[model samples]
Target: MEQKKRKSSATIASIETEYVRSLQKKASRKHARKIRLYRRLTVFAVVAAIILVGMTQMYMKQKQVLEAKELEKMEKTAQLEEVQQEQEALNRQLIKLDDDDYIAKLARKDYFLSENNEIIFSIPENKKKTDKKDNGKE
Candidate 1:
């Protein structure tokens, strides 16, 4: 009888030790899982930040390029308008040159030409007033 009682007590002690060991293992596994989860979250946050910064830089660069193109477009438009105005003035001069009367006047004034049996007279310009002003300034 005493032998049976001792055997039962020893068995209960072994079972209690096993239960305590299992509990310790469970706590350790939970702690390790928490650490792993924290590490994963940290890595995810870092990667997200890097991606955000990269996208922002790309957007800013593209915006700058677009602004430069817009400025170039404005400059080209202004130059085209100026060229068109110059072309209009040249067209007007071309029209004037096509007239016979204008051509005759231009030839007489610039080349000292005259028609047959026509008389031409020459007169000096009034340069004395301009000369006096220039002499005083100089």
Candidate 2:
């Protein structure tokens, strides 16, 4: 009777130990799953942060490009003003084309025409100096 009682108690203790080990294993699995979920969340957060920074940089770069384009437009506007001034001067020169003295000068210089009794002497400047360079090989 005593041996039977001891055997029953020993079997109950072994069952309790097995149940405790199983519970511990389940708890460890739960903790591991939580850790894995946290790691995934961390990775997602990092990716999101990087994308935000990249978008900000792209926006800033585009802004800089737009500002440069605007500055170029301003420079072009200034250049246009200078060109307008030159155009006005050219228009004044055109208005003078009907003058008889100017027409005579143009005919003499461009068409090489002169009055009947005038003696025309032509002297051409040498053009060789315009083609010279300091290169030793050439």
Candidate 3:
């Protein structure tokens, strides 16, 4: 069986004394103070979280920039080394070109030029290839 409860249509009166009023005011003030304290703490926590995130983002950006700079520096250093090596090779070639004997030998080989009393013999490319092969076999 289910029972239905009826509401009482009656009004209750509270004691209206100075001591009761003072106690109620004190209780309300304490509740208000607690609310204010909680609000302040929430604001502080939010600000601190924002500051921490900002610092972390800044640190990550700086780290990425530093890594990129180091990579660029390494690439530039490699390029500089290659350029230095090429310069050294050119310097050696220049020194060799300054020698008269080397220049004469280069000219004779490339231009088929001969010195006085020296007969220039023109060998066929096919004969030279065959000679190289025979030498290798030996």
Candidate 4:
């Protein structure tokens, strides 16, 4: 009966040791899982940061290109407006040239022409001579 009692005590001690070892193993596994989770989260954050920076740079570049195009459009619009004004002036001049009176006036003024049996007398502008005499008197 004493031998049976010693054998039972030894069995209980071995079972207790086995239970402690299993608890230690489970703690180690939990620690390892925590480390792996931290590493995965860190890697994901770095990749996300890189992607965000790249997208911002691309957006700025596209904005600059769009602004340049808009400026060019404005310049072209101004140039077109100027050309349209010049074309309108030329059209009015062309219409004026179709009138006989305007043609006669242009010829008489620019070419010194006169009608048949009409005499032309030439007169110099008196304002310049008068201004010169006035200055001399002063």
Candidate 5:
């Protein structure tokens, strides 16, 4: 009975040692897998940070370029308005030229003409001293 008890005790001790060794190996494997996953996640996070910075820089540059284009467009619009005002002024002058009284007065001052065959009278009191260049003939 003593030898049987000793043999059984040895067998139980061996089984316990084997089970503890197995559990240690499985835990080490799980810890190694966790370390590998942590490395992959760290690499992914770094890549995402770099990409985010690059995209933000690109957005700022594009926004500046668009703002410059908008300013240029506004300048061009102001120039167009000035040209339009000049064109309207010329149109008004053209309308004045089309008036019969204005044209007839211009013709009488530019060319000697009379409604009837009347003699030309030069009144010294009505005549003011002027040069030929001042009259725009030179």
Candidate 6:
């Protein structure tokens, strides 16, 4: 069996009215406002991120400086301790120098001085070992 097909053409037209135009205008304005709000939020987020990064970098730099200063302070404290010990030793030596008996003993030992008829005997001893032991005690 053979059948013929028929085609029907139909055209639709857009409705144009004052109320519809006003509604379209209001929708466009709302869309524009939304876009502007999004743009402003994006700019604000970028600026906030930049400020946060800058503050973080500054904090890191300050931390490094603080650590360096602390290290320097520790070194200076050690140096001060050494200087104080040296000063104490010097003060002790000054006190010994002011003593008459200590001064006479030191002079007699170093210069081989003898009393009125007292004979001085020079004994040979291991100077190196005695010097090391005396230095250790001091």
lDDT of each: 0.93, 0.88, 0.93, 0.94, 0.85, 0.89
User: Which regions of candidate 2 fall more than 4 Å away from where they truly are?
Assistant: 1-28, 101-138
Which regions of candidate 5 are displaced past 4 Å?
1-16, 104-138
lDDT of 1 by residue, 5-86 (tens): 9899888844468889999899999999999999999999999999999999999999999999999999999999999999
Ranking by TM-score: 6, 3, 4, 1, 5, 2
Could you say which candidate leads in lDDT?
4
* Residue range 9-103, candidate 5, lDDT tens digits: 88884446888999989999999999999999999999999999999999999999999999999999999999999999999989999999988
lDDT of 4 by residue, 61-127 (tens): 9999999999999999999999999999999999999999999999988788999998877667697
TM-score of each: 0.62, 0.50, 0.63, 0.62, 0.59, 0.70
Cand. 2 TM to true fold? 0.50
For candidate 5, what is the total of clashing residue pairs? 0
lDDT of 6 at 19: 93
Q: In candidate 6, how many Å is residue 133 off?
A: 11
How many clashing residue pairs are found in candidate 6?
0
Worst 10 residues of 3 by lDDT: 1-10
Model 4 spans > 4 angstroms off: 1-16, 108-114, 117-138
- Tens-digit lDDT track for model 2 on 41-126? 99999999999999999999999999999999999999999999999999998988969899899989877889889877765544
lDDT of 4 at 114: 98
Q: Among these predicted structures, which one has the highest TM-score?
A: 6
